[model samples]
Target: MAQTPLPDHPMRYALANELHARPFPVLKAPCRAMYLAIKKVENAAERDRSEDLAHLEALLDRYGASRPAPNADQYSGKLGRGFLKWEMHTEFVTYTLFATEPHSEPFSPDLFNLFPRDWLADAPGRIVTSCVVNVETVEPEDREDYMNRNFPGWFVPESLTASAVTEDTAVVVGDFQIDEHGHMRFAVLAHPDITDSRLGRIVQRVLEVETYKSMAMLTLPTARKVSGTVAHLDRELAENAAGMARESNEAAEVLRRLLTMTAEIEALSSATAFRFGAFEAYEAIVMHRISALRERRIGDHQLLSEFMMRRFDPAMRTCRSSKGRLAELSGRAERAANLLRTRVDVANQEQNVEILKAMDRRAALQLRLQETVEGLSVVAISYYAVNLAAGLLAPIGYKLGLDKTHVVALLTVPVVIAVWLGVRRLKHTLTDGEDGHG
Candidate 1:
């Protein structure tokens, strides 16, 4: 009998498979590489992903290469003498092309011919970054001559940073400068005996360092733009907050302006939140990649990590400063708003108190007026009642042998007292009933 099998979760297989989705490319030394990153001008993450896939398929079709699966964000295919790798990220897509054969000259424009001219022009998004990376196998003895001749013409010596990385397994050099074609360049010289896979890993890390560094710097302009706006908002908030101390200040108007400022600040934060986060993450990746290099000094020149610290550190600090300022301003505005609301509430309460006092005075006047009216009503009713009694008793008095005027005179005092007592008793009864209900 077969053994009983255990059940698996619905997402178990997919989650496990996702871990191995993107693997490092296999590469050999003596190669030429081109890398391109594309991102839309607006809302790159929300752009039509289908367009990216179509662009890749079109390029693949040109070389009779295999197409990627449906909704695939990554693809690797063999070209004539080169291979192409495509990977999609949240805000951008990257294309890396590699060839085993080396280009004789350094930083040649012809190396990019691997990509179809028409296809590159018709790419779905604009090229956010692209670079020419050349990998060569240079022996330990010839390293000096290699740098002296080609390095000087292409890269500035003052700015060039070179290092021996991977436990001295390879030496990499890049000036981080844009060339005439508007593309950065990197050159790596691995030991001839190094394994192809190891070299591939090294090359990948170098490219990632460059790419992430560029991506991280994109936030600098945004930070600058936000800085100016934040400053203006800060000044306005300060003025309004100061106004709160004045007795004559318009509390409600100040609160309204604070609310409007709060809205603007919140909107700005929301709009730039993603960009700030992406910048930070990319900066971390760049630093991580540099550390992974495990670089040692090849000469007196600065290493990649040092160069980045010297140049990229300031831009990162600027971003951090702007982010911190925004936070502080938001907190200040919130406190000011709460204070203004409290003031408005207190003023309203005072006004309500005055209104209640006025109402009480009016109620006292109404009660006094009602008492005077009740007194008049009793006298008027007594007069009419006495006259009516006189008319009715006049005949009776004549029969009893008494005078009609005398009969009314005796009843007048009794009738008035009785009417006053009856009205008082009725008022008491109605007031007692209302009190019970209440």
Candidate 2:
């Protein structure tokens, strides 16, 4: 669509810019969805609002056709196309995310920074989208019928009664009845600020209201997959418990087989390669999918919180219910992801411990061998020193004493014994130090 300039009015700009916001809330890609709240109709083609009053009255049918139409100022047709027509109204809070639509890159939020918050949103990505509007020419009395017709068998967020939540009820007759414009309006009037996502919520609220006519289908394949994984894990836990409880001999055999299989699974999945393989990868995929789904709902909730004002409506209850459900689902997803993450951490730690133990054992063996070699070297040194001493004494003989041969032989024997003992002590000391250090 070609860009068109709006009137030079702050309110108009606010409505237009907010509705056409870019980079959507969740998807980083061009927006794939959007919502719009119809404000007042300005002017119809080729006629001033006043000049078109006759036709407008006929079209709106606010008062009976047999009845007289009210003054132009009192109604849209009587007043013209510029009537202040609105299903939702805002007094204090302004509209945000009034509409969303996908656009080309050159014009997409990805390319243009549309909001002040985009400074943060741009760092990541966003998804923006739009709906295909089905314009129909229908009678004015067909508003409610049209809603039920278009959205058949659909949940109406607006229809979420107080009794559904707290059994509360109030009977407030509508005083602001339709004038002579012959036009129809919504009975479920929600103040714009009252809604969580004033603009977007209106779209969804309308979706619910018109579900019988225009049902919006949602795709949750990823959500389903994660849910399936959770269920599967639940089953596995039950099976493990049942296997542990079995007492029959055959059951005992089965338990043994189960234990062996579990060990094999651990072995096969224990490798770094396997951790990076399909099983771990899919687990990660499921975690990511769950996170994304939760995030989308969270974004919706946040949008609602910001957009919703002081007005309390039935839609608010429905929105709260939806948000609560989303929170619960998110908690479940987080728990599952955390379980997998913890398992991964434990597996990695165990691998490291095993490696350290292996290194310890190998180092001990190496040190023992080294000590044996060093001990042998010390003994050889001591033996050689003893022989040298004996040789020196042999020349001197026993002249200094009584019997020279006996002195040389006995002296050598005592010297050899002392040296051998000293050498053994030195080897023992060396081995002790090595063992201590190792």
Candidate 3:
């Protein structure tokens, strides 16, 4: 008999397997890495996906490497002298290449020669950032001499931050400067005892720290651009809000202005929303990576953590402050709009009250006119009824030897009283039924 299992959800396997995706590279000491992040002028999410795929395919074909499956967001494969890992992100695509061979010179341009010049030139998007990372294995005793010799050549000693990380198994150093090739430089000195996996994690963290830090700073310019627009909106909102107190007629105009401001703020918010969120997220990632370094100071020299905090913390703070300001301004604008709307509503209510008062006056006039018409109707009906009675009673009066005028005089009061009572009773009956239904 065949075994039957319970039905599985469509995404069960994929969701469960996601944790293993993008495993860290196993990098031994004495390895070299060239990391490149590419981004289009428009966001990667908005750019044509086919274009990115085609670019990757072209690059892989040149290296005799198989292309990624369709719609795959990332791929890792061997190239000429190194293996390349490509990942497509929301706003950019990153290519990380690693080679086991170390360059003799610390900041050699020959390291970038692994990439074909023509292929790099034809890349789909501009390079947002690129870095050359060299990991060297050092004996624990020779570490100080290694830094003293290399620090002056590659980094500014005055501003150098070198520290032991991963329980002093490795020491990483960088001055965070762009070199002549327009590439940032990072180097890792690991002990021979460190495992390849731990070294890989350290290398990955360093690269990520640099990448996210660069990505996070891109938002500062956008923040500055919107700051002026927000200030102008704030002043306009304040003026419009103040106008609401002056006159009821101005309420409509104030409401219109408030709506315009709301639209403007919303538009700005929509435009910058993604950037703000990305910056915050990337900033957090940078912090996390720095923390993962577990850096300890080397001989009074600042560590990477301290250097990052001193330089990057201020920019991050500015971004945070700008975001908060935008939110506050938006909230203030919304409240002003609500206030203006309430004022307009109150004005409308007051106008309606005046209209009701006019209607009441008209209703009172109509009631008085109706009463006058009723009185005239009673007179007319009485006159006609008395005439008819006079005609009928004339014969009887002649028989009884009484006058025609006296019969009419006697019947006039009763007829008038009867018609008035009948009209009043009819009106009362209608009103009573209406009241009962209500």
Candidate 4:
């Protein structure tokens, strides 16, 4: 019987397949691998990823090997007598070439010649790191003799990190130093009993650890370059904060300086944010890869984790401290700005209050002057009115047998009173008009 078809999302199969897309290469013993990682120095994450794919295709074409799918992120195929595996990451790409043929010399520089010089010169990005890994099968009984015979001249003694990994199935050794050929080297002595898949996983982990370590260390230069500037900013922030506390310092000037400091700190944060973040992620990957090795000590030699703790951890700490200082300074600047702004606002409010008081005093003086002028106007009007009345009443006084001086005296009091009443009424009318308008 035919089963009914079920509904499915478009990306269901693609998403499920993505988990197993980049399976570990099955590597046998007595193999030598050359690993190379390439990345653009600037704007790596935003570069034209298609160019990477095109470059990979070009390499595949040179070998007459089958090309990867158009959208594939990883590909593996045969190259001459060896196998080639290519992977694209967010900010870089990696190529790993495995040669199964046994070599006469361990850590030989000639193994890197498989990659043509012209091809490397034509790469779209600069080399981030390159390493050569030698894999050998050594019986447990012969492991000590093997290490004593080959490890001394090949790797430095003080920085050597040797460990038995995967429950003693293999021993891994590295000095974390670049050789005269400008390539890092690692050796994996696998027990005869280990499976090919397990050996491949071990080799992959070793490469990942080294690659991520180099990537993480890239942030060190950035941190060192910015350290002096950051220190200067820190001192400036402290000075501004001190100025804010002093009453004699101008709040506006201090505020302007604080704003400038804030802008500079913000710019620093923006500039370093991506690098610091990438460093942390790469650092975590390096540690996780090392931890996954499940390393057990080989004699008195340091383990990989111990080597990292001593050599690499300090740089990591520096980057963390720089990021933290930036954050602390940003916070301090913000607080200082807020406090200065409040001080400026209060000062302005006090000034405004003084201005209002001055206006009130001027308004009071003007009212007194207006009152004095109105009184003088009333007196002048009364004097004129009394004279005019006496002059007109002189005829009546003569007809009634009265003297001009008596008429003048009678007109003076009545005329002055009338004029005063009229002036008072006019003032009342004008005051009422002003009140109504208001």
Q: Candidates' lDDT values, in order?
A: 0.88, 0.34, 0.85, 0.90
- Report the C-alpha lDDT of model 4 over 1-438, residue by residue, as the tens digit: 124587677888789898998898898898999999999999898999999998888878887889999978999999877799999998899999999888888888676776778888888899999999999999988998999998999899989999999999999999989999999999999999999999999999999999999999999998886787888988888888888778854889989989888898899889899999999999999999999999999889899999999999999999888878778888988888898989999999999999999999999999999889878887898788878887888999999988888888888877778877888899899999999999
How does candidate 2 fare on TM-score? 0.30
Off by over 4 Å in 1: 1-4, 395-406, 425-438
lDDT rank order: 4, 1, 3, 2
lDDT of 2 by residue, 1-438 (tens): 326674465577657865654222221111122122221221111223332344334434533333124422222111121111211121000112322333432112221122224332321212111122211223334434544553332223332221100011110011112213221122222222232333233223322232211111111222333345445544554564465455433443444444544443334223212212322333333333223222112111121112222222233333333333434444443444444445446666877999999999999999999779766765676567666766677656645653545645566567666766786788789989999999
Task: Give the number of the best model, judged by TM-score.
Answer: 1
Error of 3 at 236 (Å): 2.0
RMSD of each: 2.4, 20.2, 3.2, 3.2
* lDDT per residue (tens digit) for residues 1-438 in model 1: 124486677887778878877777778888878899988878887899999999999988888889999999788888768788899888888999888775677777675787888999999889878888888889988888887878888787878999999988889999998899888889998898989888888988998898888889989999999899999999999899889988864889989999999999999998988888889999999999999989999768899999999999899999988888888888889999998999999999999999999999999999999999999989999999999999999999989887888888978999999999999999999999999999
Residue 414 displacement in candidate 2 (angstroms): 4.7
15-62 in candidate 3: lDDT tens per residue?
A: 877777677899887888999988886565588877878888998888
lDDT of candidate model 1 versus the reference: 0.88
Candidate 1: minimum summed lDDT over ten consecutive residues — where?
Answer: 1-10
Candidate 3 error regions (>4 Å): 1-9, 46-50, 102-104, 156-159, 245-247, 425-438
Q: Number of clashing residue pairs in every model?
A: 0, 35, 0, 0
